[model samples]
Target: MPLSSEPKLISGNANRPLASAIARRMSMHRALNVELVDARVERFNDGEIFVEMFENVRGQDMFIIQPTSNPANDNLMELLIMTDALRRSSAQRITAVIPYFGYARQDRRAKARTPISAKLVANMLTEAGVERVLTMDLHAAQIQGFFDIPVDNLYASPVFALDIKHHFRGNIDDVMVVSPDVGGVARARELAKRINAPLAIVDKRREKAGEVAEMTVIGDVSGKSCIIVDDICDTAGTLCKAAETLINAGAAEVHAYITHGVLSGPAVERIENSVMKSLVITDSIEAPEPVANARNIRIVPTAPLFAQAIMSIWQGNSVSSLFDHETLSTIYDGFYSAS
Candidate 1:
């Protein structure tokens, strides 16, 4: 592996641990010379972001790992600035590896005069000179159309499926994958298919954002263990309410497997008192202290998955194969050994 061929992996303040983990995995194989680029992103007293790359990245492929989670504006601006810096440094290519794309929920114009923040973000990244985009489980799959560059929208179902299997010990006779709302049925169905379990949906109406009306169980959850699947969990209002509804409908147990744990506001406290047996989430967003300390919550690392995808992308191989169990099971099998 020559230094010239190694891809430069950069990290923003968003999720440094996750970026470090990806770099570690990329270097583990030894054959791939991918390494984290030496860089510093700092904020001035007036809150302006400044990015400095210590090493030369001239004509090298660069992947910037940053998740626009909490403090979404600052982190997003950091990513844009970092990309612009790398572009000016003459990097051969720049890929924005955004694990959790903030403002994704506001992807559409729900009202007459509202803006499509997701599209605006795509435009910003493009204007910042990013040549490629990589993210996982966007709130709306259609958000990919918002980008002019190639966008790889990865799924957490493979990771979630592996963890679910380990916890259930291959016993899925009474397991049921549930969609918290009508919009999430596709995601829930994919997980259900992977686990070979029945699918259920929670019928609920929302009068406004972050609030859910009383939910009704649409399928037979009686005596069946249920796992609610969704792309994001912000306030956990809908999740908590759905869990209660499932319990009232005679569900044996209720769990949640959301891709992004935005866990804002009173989300942690809500989960603490909710009827959910467990709450599983991927490390797409750097969870806060309360989410990390939550008893019923478990965090799964997604660095390996992203690393493999990046490797495939750089090698010009099929990135989709990384999600195939037969091809990558060994790679992801022990990822959650701590759990």
Candidate 2:
């Protein structure tokens, strides 16, 4: 499907490959008059950010592709500044397409003095001239309420389920989708339902703040191929530990499918040395060098899903089909084959 006019697509330094892939995907359609805006987003020696657009964006529907991932502060600043620049240039609409939203883990105040950073970021974007927001697998769904403007939060489960069905259809009878924590049960259940597999949850409890969490499986995983599904993989502490616990609990093999791989600190090393079969992550965040070279880590593209959603939003079409496994599976699989 194509729009009446070409939308302006611009990207910051956060994830150029994803942005370019999205542009490439949309341009494949003959009827889609698409244009990737020429822009430069850089920082000065004094640590000040600078944004300059080479093309005219007046009255154009602009979408900025920038994931606030690693170096979160810098990337987030770029998004804010770019939105401000687009608004100042008289663009018709500005949509912030953040594949991996930063500060999402701080959606609520767990402690007395803590700040709801997620809400603060939402307020910041709206104030900076972002009329719409499109992100994937938000840590907390309630974060959507923080924004006054329209926010389209996408799920990566469709892609993951499709991949699971395609690759493991032969042995899916023995597969079980596992949630890393009780909070993620709904997400896990959705994937399990899509694949017609059983669902399980991991009960994690920590004695102290700095102590490792004690994990216990809440369902039968004996002789089952367990796949842990979660939204983020920061530090990889809980994830590696959960994999070990599942293996000890008689799981046939342990694999992880996390949406955003904000693998920081010793995450790569811990995952490399863990007993898990493999760790799969989406290209929501720009992966670091170690993650790319890790023996057991794999990355799948989210570009096609994003491009599909962008086109739907711009065309005023229903995005509900994106959540259907039968419909999206075909679209998801076709993107890889054609890409």
lDDT for each residue of candidate 1 in 161-260, tens digit (9 for 90 to 100): 8888778864578899999989899999998988789999999977876577568889999999999999988889878999999999999999999999
* Error at 57, model 2, angstroms: 0.2
RMSD value for candidate 1: 2.2
Residue 210 alpha-carbon offset, candidate 1, angstroms: 4.3
Please give each candidate's TM-score: 0.96, 0.96
CA deviation > 4 Å runs, candidate 1: 1-4, 207-210, 336-339
RMSD of each: 2.2, 2.1
Q: Looking at candidate 2, what is the lDDT of residue 218?
A: 94
For 1-339, candidate 2 gives per-residue lDDT tens digits of 333377779999999989988888788842564657888899999999999999999988899999998789999999999999999999988999999999998999898998999999999999999999999999999999999999899999988887787667679899999999999999999899988899989999989985665899999999999999999999999998999999999999999999999999999999999998899999999888999999999998888788888888887777767887666655566643211
Task: Give the TM-score (vs. native) of candidate 1.
Answer: 0.96
